[model samples]
Target: MNVRTHILRRNNTGGIFHQRGVAALLLVLLVGISATVVTLGTMSYVRGSQKSQLTVHGQTQAEINAWSGAEALGQYLNGIEVETVTTAMDDIVFSRDNQTIASAQYKPDCSQTSRDLYCFDVNGISAGHNSNLEVVYQIPIIRDVSYTEISNPIVIKGDTEVTGGGMAYLSSDSIDGFAVDGNLTITNATKSIASGCATGNIHVNGGGVEDNGHLYSSNGDITLEGLNLVGADIWGGNINVLAGSGFHFKSIKAVKNLKVTNAGNFKSDFIHANAVSFALEGQLGETLVHSDIAFGNGKSHLDYLEAGGNLIFHQDDQSHVPEFTRNSKIAGKILLRTGEDGNTLSTHYNSTFKNIEQGRTATDPGVPEWPECNVDATPFDVNTLISQANYIFYIDESDKPMLKIQNVKRASDDKSIDATINLSSEGGMNTAYLHNKPFFQCEWDSKSCITSKSNSTDGWVFEGVTHFPPGVILFAGKGNPNQRNLAPMNFTLASKSEKVGPLLNTILVTGDITLGRGGGRKEIHAPYFSSPDAVCDGDFYPANLCDKSSGSWQFEGKWDGDRVERNYPVANTSIMVNHTMTSEGWSLEGSVIVGDTFKTDSNLTNVHGVVVIGLNSDEGGMKITQGGIVVDFMDLDSNFLNIPTGNTQVTDESTLGIPTAMWARYY
Candidate 1:
């Protein structure tokens, strides 16, 4: 029984040992499964991190490529030859290693208030990622001198009559034309009128007319009496060729009638007239007459004559016969309107008629409509100048000091006055005067009060004087226009000293401006005026003064005193006058816009720049009585004029575009 108990105890212990072994095995399997799950989780996290890093790098590369594309577009725009962005453009690509990294396109947005603004869109692709960037830019607008009415050398709103002994030569290198709103009469003087348009009659009496251009008398006749007309195409209502007149014309078109009486050497390439009458002797080339034609008395030569009505050959004397060349063709019926002898008519028909057909067709070149006048005389009121003026001066006869000066603050950071005006009195004549004592310094030796400052912060300086750095001087006369007793503001610049008078730029005068004394020694010297940013030291004028290789700024003025020889460059200064501008033998430079007549009595030595006449009034024109003036028109740069703000259109082909503003953004 003891042995049996021992065996059961042993079996029990063995069973307990087996159960512990099973628990150990189960613990080992649990550890292995936990390790496998942790390893799999770690592997998945590592793969996800690597994929996220690649995606971030691709996006960064795409953004960089977009910026690069924007830069490339900017470079392309800078390299293009066109001045302004006219239309939407595309197809600009940035590529490397034969792979396109980005593409850019230019899109113009003209609907905005700023007209010249544009935008560029850049799309970048790198490593399967894409990005977009938009860049905005603004372009500056540059105006040209051709857009202004001052481009013409002469603009006259009223009658222009050259009636002196000396010749009046009108020519321009830029436009070679003149505009006259009224009658253009050149009598007793030799005048060379360029391509011109006259609203009234054009009468050339005893003067020579040589223009290699067209002349149109829009509403009246063209009378050439005792003159030589050469190289001109004339269009008028009636062309009357009086006695002893010679014509070498390209073409002549008369709407009403063309009469030639005892005219010598009438030659034209083509002639069209409603009714033509030739008496005495004349020569005519290819002519088309809409109505009747009468050839009387003298031997006449006609080539290719086409008449809509009858072609009459009248013989007052039996000996005189109207002869024509074999090239002559008559499209109308030949009739002896006022000849008693039928035998003379038969002889003339046999000698003159080459081809006479009643039903032959003739092309009528219709009369050209009158050319529009290029004179844009928009009245520039003095009040407008006053509103924009930095300094205003009023001259009154009643005040103790005749001159009153007023300074206006145009900007917050305005600089001190850096300009001067010289006033001098010579031989009881008050030549120059400016009121302010601080701005005027007297030179005791020359008896002249020189107005000048020591330094200037802005504007251009010439011969120790600053002009229009950012200032404009206005001279107003406190006088009534209707009352002759109360004198209007008349500023006469008569210099008896060696130095010039007040050299002012961009001046507005409400009164008349008399340049120089009659037969006096006063001379004016001015340099080429430009903007403050202009580099005047190149091939241009004021720069050419320092260049010894270039000749002196040609001054052909005959100064009366010790000839003050200085560089007189072509000035771009503006002188606006409300009344007549009388030049009494003075040498003047710069542009002058006159509201009244530009009258010259003595010899005008040298007159440079453009002269706009009859701006405010239609009663006055250019009247040169004695002196022979030469107006050398210089094209002023666009920077001198006021540029209006807004969306700028590409109006001129010579415009220059500059990128003013730029911004970029990523999308």
Candidate 2:
């Protein structure tokens, strides 16, 4: 505004104005730089978000496709005929919409040694993701392990070689494998194998020779010692390990005369012998045997020991017994297999025990009772079979009874009761297992009865005239054995009786057999039978014993063995029985049980087959004094015990436990 008029003054003002102008320009440049930085940062953020989403989606798709590849491989394997030789992949591809999505390499797992075992290992890839899966398809053979009754001894000798107990499971409760009633001698050096069947046992009678196996007489004091025993088990005759030797890994069990010689370093889970003798062995892992340690002289480690006869700490001569070393102690508990509270172990030494428990005689198979009867049993004569041999009855629980009887006298309360058999009076079956066809009675001409494809039909075996798929049997009783205060009901034959299983043909009892008991305070007497012969005419109180055209029964006691087909009886199985039992000359074939409290002064009576006694009772016990002898168990062909034919690993599903695409990885 002042123009050239104040030239001199303007010159001075011009310098200050120029400085302000320069400052304004610098501010504009800074604003432009800030705008450019904001725009670039926003663009970079958007681009990063897009890339993250794409990567996530792509990886997820890759995993899903990889699983798809696995499923495809599974289908192929399922369809192909399996061979022992593994099948390798030859550029096989899986696609969707004609676009390749997955590829897999499958290698079958087959055992040439085992004719019918197969499996598959699949390696799959999709996009960049990969997965590996294993699938089994077949089962193994039954002969991999078996135990037959052998007369000759089985001897194995070799340092490196092994007489495997055969390939089977190994555990405390049950094992699968074979057992020999005769002697099994494993001397030389090879380690013996243990039986692995749960329902099966391997017993040696001639005496287990651990001759590098064992050293004992045949049928004499049994000494369970397989030549080179690693985990094998032997249950022949009376067991005695008194050869002044030591055991490393062992479970010595015997029916009688069990003596351990403390001469070797012992290590194992148990020494469950009838006459178990050990001293000063603690549970360092499992108790190990030491040669220096003597019987009853020191501390001994044991899980459990149940003696049928007298539990002796030393042999008769006391030569095999050792003196206590280190400390006189019993590391674990020792159980006497009897219900007598006052029964004591004959220990003749001054020692200390941690725990010494008592085993009460009782049955613990909590099988439920029945509900009703469907059998149409007509009144008939109770005699006629007195001329035949003894009678055997297989009693089981049932929901539907096919035979009905009325007005029968009970053994315990001496009362008459009407009941139906094969019928349950309370609930349904514990297991809803229905056989495809009868085990016997081959439906006229059904080709599927003899042989089956496991899935197509129910496998069955029927011998003699006795039918397979027999209806479950029910005994009439009003007592619950589980409750000690509650009394049991009885269905007895005479004064002394027992129940023998497996009506080889058809067991016919010609006496009053009472069944179907509700609830009462009475003892249930379950008995096994003996060999019956023809009763003399004078023995028959009623003349027309066989001809019972009338309702009243004519015979006092008579059971016939005529309905049997093949003689297979189930043994050592948990059965339902009452508290009190009394019988002499009873030969129960199939299993073993011991320790009675009843003091019955009897004569020399020999017992064969499976004789189970002194179990599931806290009441008065029994003691069979004098001439009563308990023998070994031998029959196996006809029994309720079923051993799996194929390998234990196989299942009905056929895929083992592996999964296809529908499976989640278990890390």
Candidate 3:
């Protein structure tokens, strides 16, 4: 019985051990499953975090790229034409190393005629986007005028007939050509019509009435009092020659009607009129006259007449317009109605219409549409540009100031600049100030160091500036008083033509520039014994010192570092006679501009470069007494604006320092 109990105990013990081992195994399995689930969750979290970081980085890069594109666009659009941008531009792609990434679109607001509005849209990596874009406007401030293409003869607008018995004379001092932007009327029998003239059709938006360029106008009745038709053509409206007024030269045509009463000595190949009425002793030319209404009531003869309406040559009881031979001994040819048949022509006193040519009266050479004026394509207003300069000067206003230019340069592809500046008023150390005394060094009888002891300008060197950016306007002041006849001031040019072109020497005078008087009245009395204003008020210098012969500017261009090469003053070598230049000499080598008048009545004026007249000081604009003005018109081919835009490079900005505006207008 003892042996059996022991065996049972051992068996029981073995069963217990087995049960404990199974429990341990189960626990280990549970722990292992929990660890696996936690690891899997952690791995998933890490991946999600990485994705979020990557997205943030991409958004930052896109924002940077969008701004970079905006910077580049500002430069590219500068100096670009409005029409070109409107046509060729769409969506713009921004690039890095030529690899395009960001894209931007442009929308222009063409509402304001004077300016443009630009808008841009850029998509970024981030969810945010911009609809409002920065706007930049490129504006030009001024432009020079161009004179080309001469009009044909018989150009008449309104009643452009000068009829006076006092006789009109053709003077060499007359303007070569005159363009009026509005209606023109010269009823002065003593008035001499010298040059060809043009007028605008409409009298409003395009109307800027000026007797400018000796010959250019826009619209209105160009009536005449005493007609002196030289080699000129009158273009405008109605033409009327009342009572005994005569045309001695070439062509008189009108878009309206031409009425001639006792006119004299008019010779031409062509004359077009809406209606022509001639009475009494009117001398006709060996030319063609086309009119809507043709009537020669008194003794007005016509060579070849083309009348659109009734044609009548009534003398006493006879009623029919007459025609004559081409080589007739009379002053003019016979009349032929433009719309009337040449076969139905008749004349008084048994005169015949047999000598006229049948083929010459086919179609009337029609006049150009009214206001046949041409406009320059430059993108700036001249008056506004001049007024906005950083430095503005009026020569001859206080005194004829001097200019000593150092240099001019194009600092970038879009900008041209000049760094060297030595204006006469701010004449630097060692430069000769000739405004007061060009003949002497320093002030008149003094040995002070205020001015250089020597009168030589050979060693004058330019001082270069690095900091000042390019394209900065430098306006010389207009001085204390407005620039009137610049009597006391005289300029001395140190010619550096090989170095600098005939440009205003870092100095520009805004007013009239009268160099010398006609006879001998040209002098500026400012002796150095007293204060500047006091001396001028004190009235120094010889009374006749301001004589026309004495008002010549001095030139020391060829100063060979020691002595001036010559004592005589050169007109246009190193000096540009700014503003209106009135002088006695016959030759002008450099550029000249007249704000009021360019009167060279002393002799014939020969201009090498540009000769522009903003205004005429004379009864007309310019009066060249004898030699007949000869202009090289080629002088107009260069960058006409002589304003000093300091020559300095702005490297970082792509604008080349050109002016730009954000144009406060928003989307």
Candidate 4:
């Protein structure tokens, strides 16, 4: 029974062992499956992390590249035009494939035209990016090359060549001439002579010589400067030159016309021409004339004849200038006259004075005529004639005293007054009257007192009051009073070639006029007049004078013995035009005509040209009848301000990058 139980147990034990082995195997399999699953999940997590990291890196690189491109584009745009950061940063892409990125231009929210806005972006790491781009950059678009064609004449500073047929010759360089219809200037060029055969004009200033040695201009004006014409003949319609302006003519023989203008205070010694007309405008410093001179068909005065040839002066038209004629000779006629007015004046041959009476004209019967009146030894000194006077004359309230006559003595040929007369006087009247004849009187007032004589007889006749006009005036003290004591007066001058009427006007200077009460109430015109009571007391020059008392100015008239005080010095109501004066450094008021030849310095840094033309409430403003011009001393072929803007683009060719341009404007 024991043996049977043992076998059964052994069998049971073997079965249990088998069962345990199976269970173990199944546990191992399940554990292995769970481990495999964990491993797979970890692997998957790691792969996803790597992919995200790669994408982030790519995006960062793209951002860096985009930012770098933005900076480069900003720097590039900096050189072209005014651009704002806000307007230069949008839509910016960084890609190696397209290699191009443009930032979105921003417009200011304020709608300001003067300002711009901008934005920026990256493209290399965008959603649709497909580039193997290590980096991408953006740069500004720069204009490198350009081409232009000018239909009209183009003036350049350096040199320009024209392949087409056109006239381009001036005083400076070579010219190519066709049917030239425009003005051509070739100044200061070396290899500039081309070919042009048109009727156009050309002005060459300074070219050595042409390879062909020929200059031709039909129906055109030609001027050459600084040139030596050895045997060259310039067949131009008209020509002009100055002696010192680099022009040397073997002999200027023209078939049309010639004009020579001298500016260096020198004269042209030789001039031989064959023209229907000739014009010579020059300043006669110290020149000798070898040809007969003719005057324009106008009134003129002949003073002397001392040239080598017979100085024949005649009147003719501009087309018939005698000096240009081949058979012209010298003839002489001279005359000299003395008087403020041209008519009723004393001629050199006559001594007696003549007066203008009615329409008929007659000379003084007592004076000599022609050759008899030529008294070379006669002594007539303007200064010594008025040195010893005897009259103490005072006008209204004038501090400056006029001549006073003491004792009158009639000589055989000239009248003389006693040499003892006091010239210094203030405001008071003469306490003791010594000589009170029917022609003399003395009066006194609060502001003025005068001692004078007034009569139609031989005595001093105080008539036609001396009035001070309202205008700019010059005052010269007692010493050397006649030099520039007054502004220039308008005087008619009749010259041989032209007759220029009164060119200027006179200004009145009041010495003792005072304004009414209250210190600042006095109104004084500056720069021209002096105020004896204001800041510049009626006296100007040497210092600014101030007027102490203010009172309305009044005019006063007085002669040798007749004195009238408290009268306003009224100006003559004659026909006189107003003046327009432009004040540069000084003030010039009132109405007056301005001469056309006014000068102003443009290069003077601190000097100002102040011109005041026309006055308020004046009858007429200053009239600019003719010219206000500036003619430079440069050669006719050279223009100071006619240079072209090279290529119409900025270039690094020169330091300034472009040729200087010349311009002129009228305001």
Question: What C-alpha RMSD separates each model from the true structure?
Answer: 25.8, 34.0, 26.7, 40.9
List lDDT for all candidates, in order. Answer: 0.48, 0.26, 0.32, 0.24
lDDT of 3: 0.32
Question: 609 in model 2: Cα distance from truth in Å?
Answer: 3.3
For candidate 3, report its TM-score.
Answer: 0.38
Lowest summed lDDT across 10 adjacent residues in model 4 is found at: 1-10
lDDT of 3 by residue, 1-667 (tens): 0000000111212231122111211111111111110111100111110001000011234443443444455545543445545555677665545555456565555434233234455443223543223334333322221222222211122222222211121223332333332233333223332344444331111111122212334455554433444444544577655433335435556667666655565444446656566654344564333434345544445565544334445433333435454532222233343324333454333345445333333445344455455321111112232312222222323333332111112212212221122334354422222223221122212222223311222111111111111111222322322112222222222111222112221122333333332322122211111122221111122111011223442221223322121111111221122334455433444444443344443434454433444322222244333223444433232222221111121122211112233321113
lDDT of 4: 0.24
Q: Could you tell which candidate, 2 or 3, scores higher by TM-score?
A: 3
Order candidates by TM-score, high to low: 1, 3, 2, 4
Assess candidate 1 and give its TM-score to the true structure: 0.55
- Residue by residue across 421-522, what tens digits does model 2's lDDT show? 232334221111212322222222222122221111211111111122221122222222111112122323222111213322122221112211112111
Which residue window of length 10 is worst by lDDT in model 2?
Answer: 48-57
**What lDDT is reached at residue 199 by model 4?**
36
Candidate maximizing lDDT: 1
* Per-candidate TM-score against the hidden true structure: 0.55, 0.21, 0.38, 0.19
- Count clashing pairs, candidate 1: 3
Better of 1 and 2 by TM-score: 1
Candidate 4 residue-wise lDDT at 263: 19
